[model samples]
Target: MAADTAKVDPMHQFAIEPLFGSDWTFAGHNIAFTNSALWMLIAGICLWIFMIGGMKREVVPGRWQMAVETMTGFIDDLLEANMGKEGRKYVPYVFTLFMFILFANLLGLIPLPLAMAGVHAFTFTSHFTVTGVLAIMTFAIVLTVGFWKHGLHFFSLFVPHGTPPLMIPLIFVIELISFLFRPFSLGLRLFVAMMSGHVLLEVLSSFVIDAANAGPGYGVLIGGPSFILMIAICALELLVAGIQAYVFALLTSLYINDAEHLH
Candidate 1:
């Protein structure tokens, strides 16, 4: 009984099980809809409703409208601060990325039951693949914009402006490696943060449940404090979700700036 109680599988929460009756594969790929896909779809739809459905020109904006406006203004300021006037052209893409990520992170925090019977929640951002793809997309945009604006001169990004002739080769190698690692770094930061936080919550929750089942004395002594800590962690995770989204967007904008200006 004690052994069973200690078998808290916090990592089980991250499993990507098929949503339908069974797993389906088409051609050579397992493209069956999973909890991750479902949560992504949910996040996308929620963002659409919050941003597009609320766009009514009113003297006094409704709550939804105000929320939409606030988000728009915040992104606008972020872009302007990072990328200057040229940032306006990329607003649609950057804003969409920001909103999708923000919604995805927030949606993951919601305890929604999956179509699969056992799973209770899905955190799309906690998956490295999801964040990796997003980071790659951002990197691709930076490269495309840089080459389009500056042609082969975009290669100058890897070369520092003021370098001793002998040190130029070494600096280029170092800078090139740093530039190439951006996507991995960006993706890993978000993935690790989300996954670790959720795992911690799951572990704490399991302890609380175990303590509650033990006895009233154990519940008051252990479960109560565990529950309170879980709540505090959940609040911190909420803030972390927002901060990670903002950081991702901000870094993308800064990368765009580097690409455009080429320091």
Candidate 2:
């Protein structure tokens, strides 16, 4: 039993296995409906239902309606606080980002009997590739909006307004590097946080399972504390899921502000 626990692979949760028929290769590219892709699609659908289905005009809002309104207002306030009036135009993009991430993060916590059924549960955002793509999309938007609005003047963003002429070149190089690293940093932050938390949970769960297999006495002695800690960690992860989503959206809004105002 102890040996089995030792062999438990916490990182296995992040594997992107094919969801349909055996993995296929087309034109030297592997195209398969992976668990990651499925989870992403599920998250998108859930978000659509939450936002679109809740759009019923009522004089007295129900719980679901209130939840939808509160979420909308929260994102609206987030954009307005960061980008002022100009941020209004980006509500759709930012809101979509927030909903996708929030739902993905939350969905990952749902424990299904996948192993018993020869399947596996996965968290799309736990993979760096997914988060990296999201970060790149946000970065691309920033660049497009910046260049479109400022033309060649977008390059001027790398130079501080009050920099000494002699130091301008050095500052520009530093700023350029900083700008280029945004996607990596943003993606890594989310991936590491989600991955690490899930890994810890898996490890604790393994301990609980091992204790139960050993005996009722051992289960009471060991599994009890492990189970309590698991619950606490789960609650914390739920809070983190929401916070990381908000942070990602808030940072995007700030980046948009930088592009628009060049400050």
Mind giving the per-residue lDDT tens digits that candidate 2 earns over 1-263? 46564566788888788878556778988878888888899898889889764688687988888999898889899999888899899998999998899999999988777765746557899989899999999999999999999998999999979999999999999999998888898888888889999999999988888888888999999989999999999999999899889888988888888898897
lDDT of 1 at 190: 90
Worst 10 residues of 1 by lDDT: 112-121
Extract clashing residue pairs from model 1. Answer: none
| TM-scores for every candidate against the unseen true structure | 0.92, 0.92
Candidate 2 regions exceeding 4 Å error are 21-28, 113-115, 118-120, 214-218
Give per-residue CA lDDT, model 1, range 1-263, as digits (tens): 87484667989888998887355778867788888899889898888778774569787998888888888888888888887888888788788988898888888887655624665768889999999999999999889988998999998898887888999889989998999999899889999999999999999988897887888899889999999999999999999999999889999889989988888
**Each candidate's lDDT (Cα)?**
0.87, 0.88
Tell me the spans in candidate 1 whose CA falls farther than 4 Å from its real position: 2-6, 21-27, 112-119
